[model samples]
Target chain A: MTEMAHALRVQNLSKSFNDNSVLRGISLDVATHEVVCLIGASGSGKSTLLRCINLLEPVNAGRIWLGDEEITRAGIDEDRVRQRIGIVFQAFNLFPHMTVLRNITLGPREALGLSRSEADERARGLLERFGLSEKSDDYPDRLSGGQQQRVAIVRALAMDPELILLDEVTSALDPELIAEVLNLIRELAGRGMTMVIATHEMSFARDIADRVCFLDEGVIAEAGPPDQIFTAPSHPRTQRFLQRIIAAGRM
Target chain B: MGDTKRSAGRGSRLLGNRAVLVSTTSTILFFIAVAVVVALAPGSDIVGERFLNWVHLKQSLLGTATAPSVAEAFLLNVRMFMIAEAIILVLALVIALVRGVPGPVFFPFRAVAVVYTDIFRGVPLILVLYMIGFGVPGLGLGYVSTRSDITYGIIALVLVYSAYVAEVYRAGIDSVHQSQTAAARSLGLSRWQSMRFVVLPQAVRRVIPPLLNDFIGLQKDTALVSVLGSIEAARAAQIYGAEQFNYSAYVVAALLFVLVTIPLARFTDHLIARDRRRREAGGAAPGALGTAAGAPHDVPGAIG
Candidate 1:
């Protein structure tokens, strides 16, 4: 709650794609090293909020603070802000034309102005930690769904970002492969990495998140600790949504 | 099941043999029939003397004392094509990138790119050649205007061909998904950096076959520079025909042009075939992405 401890702050963020508003009047705050998860259905604006926070998608109305700086202010350097925040997408979105090492090293070498050897050493270390050193020379398409997603995470980690945003990182993986990616996220959480994850995995969210926000329509309908949000939900829509998830055996 | 599979394979092989035999025999017979008809035509002897004279063909290729050899003159066409093609590749990509620049601040640059492509592509290459070839020299700007006609020809080819090539590059740039750009930008790379490293490499790879197609057209259009009396292959052939009153030199020139284009055409076909194979193979093939330039690339995690 203290301003000095805040890692990210979004105040009344709104975004629209033409006539369809994706995120409306959404605000949330994450403390340093704390993990927050955004849980919602298909059109619940979780992905939009993450994208807006990363400045990949410009918000229609809002202000966002990264650490001490107001990132949404006019004339702010988007590249510089993005350098401190890493994002892993649902579809991986690895550069198909680059090998895993190159994909991981491209941002540090190009944006951070790290020398080739420095970037390579950093990338290799992350790859080793993630069990992807063997696939460093291989392209993304050559890897399995799980391996590709893991490489994507390593790509974000290569920048040594202060905060990371993960948007449904397991949504595009096979059911069997989903566990590997979730385990990696759990490891990052244990390491005290500040993370904002938007996910459909009910159990993973419940286990790892310090706080959970249930988004409906374009706003966060409810926010609380995962146990309260999941087991003793207060809102009818939250109850209905959890009922659907449990009935589908997704929890 | 094994016996049936062996028999099916043998059956297919037999059918393939019969198809090859029948087609080969029919092709031979068709060529023979055409040759017989042409040889028996009433004006065959005169036509052969005028256009198919072996002696004149040899003379034109080797060159007489008065006229430059068609082969030597073709070196000029080769020079012009090489120079123009190189300039077109770089210039067209710049124009394409400029047109793709976002924000109202780049409006003027994008407008210039649009008008450039429109004016150049809309005008005929021949007209462009004439205007630049004659028009630039007419300005009489001292040393600048006094440059050789071939220089003007090369410039004209670059201008016209770049417009078409720019559109080809733009199509390629558009074909790359927005997600790729988003991923790059999110990694803290600037928009220009994202374009240079991620988008341009992929775009250029995907459009190689089409870029080669444009190059082939440019190679042939090098002949149009002869309108300025540059004495390239076509012009040399024209001179030989006029002096000797034999059209065989034109045949020699045509053959030379085809000779240069055939290898490039075959190379383009090879690239297209390789791209199709990679796309159909689910992009897991060795050396598929980046090595041979990514083709379609499995649509990014689409397999799952």
Candidate 2:
């Protein structure tokens, strides 16, 4: 993985919160513009892994590289590194006090030092494209589950990040609202935005992912093309998880 | 006819069920309390010339506060409270920020914040007033010694109350969802920037009720400054009482403080109600373990 220059190269990443270790010595890589899906049952460390990569959750052991710069090293500018990698959480952490426009423009205006007009203009463009032009003046509390999630995506996209991490972006949505968000994710992938998605939407993962990684416990149990992972998972744990999904009529 | 009577029963002013029963019982209890107090008033000599003789009480109360010799000492009390409240907000917020600051670089400042909160919160306000008001001036230091005892009084009150307000602010800051901080940090905001923009605003909003509750306490504690011989409302009342041998002057001071505090307490209650409504209406993101931003002030024991 180190020999070739991947867009994201995570080596032996480990994370723990006090007594419980969530992610243990996991290594992975994603080439530029590749859509990688992390598939796991609830506590299989998928979200933690993505969070660790985003530097939201610091790794107890390991290294992460975004493009050529090693990000996990001491004295590294974490904010600078994070500006290049956007992340969207399942709960869609939109600032309730601010209007949607301000929420989107905050990163650009404050972190990137863009002028207000410039940030607003860019944010409006994203909002227009996402079919949310009318909602720009609205507060986050006024938004539906789906609208909020899309705004969260647009917020990340406003940074023009090189890589984006999505951690179950649709899990908090209503069944109907889920489609809007999934379709937006589909649009981003169609535009060849490099993304690492941690999701439970099996069919969507199958449709969107170039490579599918099945995590069990705290390690990647299997990884391959989506077809291989979805149709014929090699590991017993992966097979069992898929079997449950299929039995639940989600696959 | 029976159905009509049943419908009227539901809306009846009198002849109702538990609502009428409760209201009637409460009214009876309230009047009984009034009667008991009134019956005991003369026995306690409170109805006599010393307590509530209308003419003597009226003159002393009005002379001491309402139309005082020094711009209405009541006004002085109001002014002192307003200044202290404003300064305490900023000062306490700074101390809370310092106390919550991360990393070892701010160790000394953080340590100072911790010790300040601990000691000031532990010491009685009257003693603290004595220390800063009298003790500091006794040191005979140049800048420390002021001709106006009010300055020393204010400093002392600020020292003691900022600790309490800082704890309230800290509790508010802590009650803010951890995910809010994480979300801000993930957006490339520095720790302080995240706090300034995202976390602090939410924390402040959530804690406004409790913070105002503290302010109400501060407003009354402004009276404690009277110990320094500042001619604020309480001291003025005490002097008037000493001269007239009627404690009705103290009643004026009490009434003045109550007049200011009642509205503030009501506003605090209003904020608390609005906050609860907002939460129930789903303003916060769905919490991680279902309690990040949902539970408010569940861990405020340290502050008290």
Best by DockQ: 1
lDDT of each candidate versus the true structure: 0.93, 0.85
In model 2, the runs with Cα more than 4 Å from the true position are A1-5, A18-20, B1-33, B40-46, B64-71, B283-304
- Model 2 over residues A1-251: C-alpha lDDT tens digits? 35654889999988889989988889999998899999999999999999989988778999999999999999989998888899999999988777789889989989999999999999999999999998887667657788889999999999999999999999988898899999999999999899999999999999999999998878898999999998888899989999999999997
Global fold similarity of model 1 (TM-score): 0.95
Interface DockQ per candidate: 0.58, 0.37
Interface RMSD of 2: 10.9
lDDT score, candidate 2: 0.85
Cα deviation of B159 in candidate 2 (Å)?
0.8
lDDT of 1 by residue, A45-144 (tens): 9998999999998889989999989999999999999999999999999998888999999999999999999999999999999888988887887788
Q: What is the lDDT of residue B191 in candidate 1?
A: 94
